[model samples]
Target: MECVFCHIVRGEAAAHLVYEDRAVVAFLDARPLFEGHVLVVPREHLPTLTDLPPQLLGPYYAVVRRLAGAVQTAMGAEGSFVAANNRVSQSVPHFHTHVVPRRRKDGLRGFFWPRGRYPDAARAAEVARRVREVVSADGAG
Candidate 1:
């Protein structure tokens, strides 16, 4: 199946584009969390963040960072929420980052879902150690 984001990237689908360049494209979300919500995607058809080539990482994030500030300024928002779902909660498979304008007393909670604290300090330390071990193994520590 053809990805909808790919169509948008190729100009095969309609989207309210806010920014576009050779490497990335930014457009308004059809169903927004708030009024100034935008979605930024790579021009390529990479399915997930892990699939994105290392060479494109810097360029991709540069656009995302710019869009974060742009959205906040354009919408007169006090802040912004920038995030991307890898695969689990991703509505579209294409690797895309959401930049949503934010303001105080916006009614939105910490996250869309409930939050929980770690069972204990030991558990938190154990989890951090496990993650750090993997990062070190990957030469990313």
Candidate 2:
């Protein structure tokens, strides 16, 4: 099907992966609105959640919950946001869930944005460090 996520699932492209199982794979977003943003997706490449098999529905939710927890812990954010897009908003044309860490004053009043850069490498490092810690600890099980 030539889906980008399918290639990601097959390890054809590089991704900062957080988790994976027989049916799904989770990885960091390359162009993150928030630093710890990650995408949880099925390996099968369904176009939307509704298109997923009944058997996959349970595991998908479980992965979402698990990824949210990991994102919060890793990014040291005040909270987390999880979203699934169905139609026009679905940028990648594949069924995926976004787990984004939310800070108290990130200026992101809503999901839409055109923001500035990290200013320096240190900020980016902080995000990466925390995400790595949380994902590593959580994935141990």
Candidate 3:
């Protein structure tokens, strides 16, 4: 109940709010990757992507898409990075998409680089099954 984003949505805390509507709110990130980095959050306090209702996805992503373009245009960057992290690296407990302006060699790294792999097909299938269970149980499969 003490989520920072929840406080922002309720206007209990100060935020440089840039956009808001019936479904979502967007604001400048206090700690940004760059000056124009923004966090677009749904008004409802869904903890992560899996918790977001399917019907709201379009509206949520519409804001993300708009923010991506706006961040790049407003910051005069060559491109933008639009991303979300779930429980692993999500600093806040609520769902939010990061729209960050980008330029060549701007120092953010690893999206294009290769990552560590699973040991083999059987091991991979086991992992896939685990993920599939969550998605399928949620009626998303």
Candidate 4:
């Protein structure tokens, strides 16, 4: 079976994509912790962050950094939470960085997982577009 994220990266699966380039692709999380939550992944099918090639690290994280700012701005968030899991807690085996929009007292607490979904596909697409706009304007896309 092919990795779902690899499918997304290859345009073989549907995703609310916010950013894409030769090295990485970013899209909205189907199950998000908050509105505008995005997942950044490499084009290659690396299983974990540690598995990412050293040459790709700078380029990969550069996109993550850009998306972190764009997601916060697009969501009108006070800040953003960026995280990654190794093999232990990774829902998908493919490597990814979660960029979650955050606000003061938004009910997320340390080490506690709370997940939510967009009310509809239209809503999710709108959120992705907003993030994409910011990323494009910032010259990160």
Tell me model 4's lDDT, rounded to 2 decimals: 0.95
User: Residue 127 CA error for candidate 3 (Å)?
Assistant: 5.3
What tens digits encode model 1's per-residue C-alpha lDDT throughout 6-92? 999999999999999998999999999999899999999998998999999999999999999999999999999999999999999
Q: Return the TM-score for each candidate structure.
A: 0.95, 0.76, 0.84, 0.78
- Stretches > 4 Å off in candidate 3: 112-114, 118-138
For this target, which candidate reaches the highest lDDT against the unseen true structure? 4
Q: Which candidate is the best by TM-score?
A: 1
lDDT of 2 by residue, 1-141 (tens): 478999999999999999999998999999988899999999997998779988999998899999999999999998898999997789998999999999888877876767688879999999989889988997732
lDDT of 3 at 141: 95
Weakest lDDT window of 10 consecutive positions for candidate 3: 108-117
- List residue ranges in candidate 4 displaced over 4 A: 113-141
lDDT of 4 by residue, 1-141 (tens): 679999999899999999999999999999999999999999999999878988999999999999999999999999999999999989999999999999999998864677689999999999999999999997769
Tens-place lDDT digits, model 3, residues 23-138:
99999999998998999999999999988988999999988998899889999999999889999889998999999999999998847457898999999999999999999997
